[model samples]
Target: MAEWDIRKLQILRTLRDRGTVTATAEALHMTPSAVSQQLTNLSRQLGVELLQAHGRRVRLTDAARLVLRHAEAVFEQLERADAELAAHARGDAGEVRVGAFSTAVSALVVPAVTTLRNTHPAITVRVREAEAQEAYELLQAGEVDLALSLAAHAPTAADPRFTRVPLLADPLDVALPQDHPLASAEEPRLADLAAEPWIYGSSGPWSDITRAACEAAGFRPHQAHAAAGWTAILAMVEAGMGVALVPRMAAVPRDGVVMRELRADRPARHVVAAVRTGAGEGGAVGRVLEALRRAAGAPAHEPPLPGPARPPGCPVGG
Candidate 1:
């Protein structure tokens, strides 16, 4: 009989990726000595020489590679077991920690929570505001049960660690001052606004998306001001500072800001819900996923509904 410490195996895997104990320690937020100690313990437990000194660096012994192969299998099985237990432990009633961008929290998560309140009243949803990239990190760290993220930044469909659920195709509309010239156009081509000043974040997915949309339209946006908040961006547009590409979910109806569609163009960000591999297949996570779909006006992906609540109308992400 043998006892295996999964944490030790994970450390070894990190070392394999980083190619050095110091690098692995940095990645895992541990001291290099601590990493060495853990691996030493693991080697003693398995009675194997997992590492061998190379020229000034260490290399994994053949035994280490073999252990890694089995370790991957063990990790997968553990994930599956976790999913099963998650489903079994919380059929429809449990706390679900959800991470999402601010806009998504308003437009999707809150509405879903309301729906779940009426349908699965016992389900408690704890919402954490996290952007697309950060949400993935939160989900990976097991700090969040579900993550609502922008599909543009979410991990690839082939990533085996997460199960992605497509939730919405949120279109972007050109936000301009109500008094701007193009404001009166029923639909303005993005090219028409090429000379206009633009409001965008200094750097981030929001900025990348806006710039990409502009480039696709054959002109670079003249970023006149940097603002990450939709509220700030829209306010700037209202004050005649600049214009911006505001996602439909985040384009709140401000009195001084008018949102206009770009003729013959639909630049949209895909919104998705992600869970740890198989966790979204059932249980509290599944119920929340279904509610989010309905909230986003998308068809429910799972048939876990007991009743329905009205979807709340609110602004959402970039």
Candidate 2:
């Protein structure tokens, strides 16, 4: 079996197009003797005569013409491959796997996916709902390209493995029964609710936020009910079970629940997107991050909140 070198094949193709060894050498930045050596080597490797003297110059043989025809298709395919790779690198086409928490899926991930579909139709975003720590674990294990996390739960900037992109600081509002006394207050104080029973997530970053906020207000929250999902937590508050601190992004207007802004202790959960240090530089990951920033700026039904400051060198779509 004979082996073919692409460089040698390219030389033959150039010679065929150039018509003479001197012209081919000049076009390829090589000496005429070097061009002749490559042609001779190619002919010997394929066990065929590729060129012959045509009066004052050389001409490609029929065998060489046949090889050049096939080589033309190979060159075209290589060019197409380069174009596709460039498109992927630019985020014009490719897939990004994202892991997010449930609330983030509702508030940020879903909207980002919709925006990507409308703008970068060739980019596919796959999202999975996972808790903050779990999302980070997925990113570390290469199971996801990007992960949405609460800032308190994310790794420090010093961690070499990941780059954090701050998205928003979702302010915590007090969810109350429509008829509750605090519901009518222009701005409720967290200290006033010290005696009230609290509805909170069973465990996780939200639970930690609730505990810290209440402690800051001079009382430990009396956890009367525990629910993992925001819908359930808000439902409990709606039924007059207890008051709950709900992040602005997670607040969905329900029949009996009214969200009141906290005046004194306006605790907020900072949301951030994390990717492998260099992974978010461009391509699908970069596009997804941009969409997330846009989504974070526009919450479903709530008043628009100020977006987090963009990190240095971070690219946010216009």
Candidate 3:
């Protein structure tokens, strides 16, 4: 078998997924005719019927299917090689693609990226804000070098396919309007505002943390609103829409909102930095991981501490 171009493998993958030349063309940003021509050329090169016509549609032949299975693995290996080579050429000049959960992106990721830029200027960092499971899939697919993930509960098993590094354990903080009375309190408890309407961030580890904290305080919070993004939830809080319990990271900054530590015994969710097994051990990913370690404030020999309480412009206390 002749060596296949990575671009052809990508096209094959797209064809396998999109199932139509038109859809695959759109995905690959090429004209339909162009995609068809490439497929024809690829088939001729392989000397096999890679695709077959079924009515107006097309489908992969059995031989194509077998080729595709191996193609995927080969393409992945090629991608890693390309990434590693790029990392080498620039003298640590590779790129680190990272997927992060909402809160992690808002708080630790931004600052960590800032540090990464200052330290390793040659390395490129591509970040995607994603949910935990989505990030995990991206990591598994080799689409991203690291995934910043969170769980309301512990993960099922520490699988050998990846390495999980605990970055931070951020507690749930209460978000109140700046004028709210409890906003200034050194520490507040869910019991303090049992009757107030609340904004919730739907269901997640962060939301679960809030619910459990409130339940431990002896009342079910009146769920006034539910949203996915912290900014939306915080914006509602800013408008005095309702008080909300969010991860400490969400409370980090933004005008017109106040975040205070919850005195309740429930601890915060753990934020994890996951890599594709050995994917991030060196090169650009390693540099970014180092910055993440610094931004998250986890020193090698020292115990972790809660990150600085928000940035300067974003007031926390009332």
lDDT of 3 by residue, 1-318 (tens): 755666776687678867899988876789999988888888778888888889999998998888777775665455456556766777777778899877677677788878767777777888898777778767755688888876432133433345566666666677899999898886777798899988876675445656666777888888889886677888999999899877676665768998777665444666667765445555687677777877778874232222222221111110
Q: For residues 178-276, could you state the per-residue lDDT of candidate 2 as single tens digits?
A: 899988987689998999999987776667778888887889999999987778988898899999988777788999999888856767777788876
TM-score (C-alpha, index-matched) for candidate 2 = 0.65
User: Which lDDT value does model 3 have at 162?
Assistant: 56
Task: Compare candidates 1 and 2 on TM-score and give the better one.
Answer: 1
Which candidate's lDDT is highest?
Answer: 1
Task: Report the lDDT tens digits of candidate 1 across residue range 42-146.
Answer: 999998999999988899999998988778677767777776686678767778899998889999999999999999998889999987788987886678988
C-alpha root-mean-square deviation, candidate 2: 19.0
Ordering by lDDT:
1, 2, 3
lDDT of 2: 0.77
* Number of clashes found in candidate 1: 2
Which candidate gets the maximum TM-score versus the true structure? 1
Off by over 4 Å in 2: 1-91, 298-318
Instruction: Give, for candidate 3, the lowest lDDT window spanning 10 residues.
Output: 309-318
Count of residue pairs whose backbone atoms collide, per candidate? 2, 0, 1
Better of 1 and 2 by lDDT: 1
Using all chains and alpha carbons, the TM-scores for the candidates as numbered come to 0.83, 0.65, 0.62
Question: For each candidate, what is the lDDT?
Answer: 0.81, 0.77, 0.70
Q: What value does the lDDT take at residue 275 in candidate 1?
A: 80
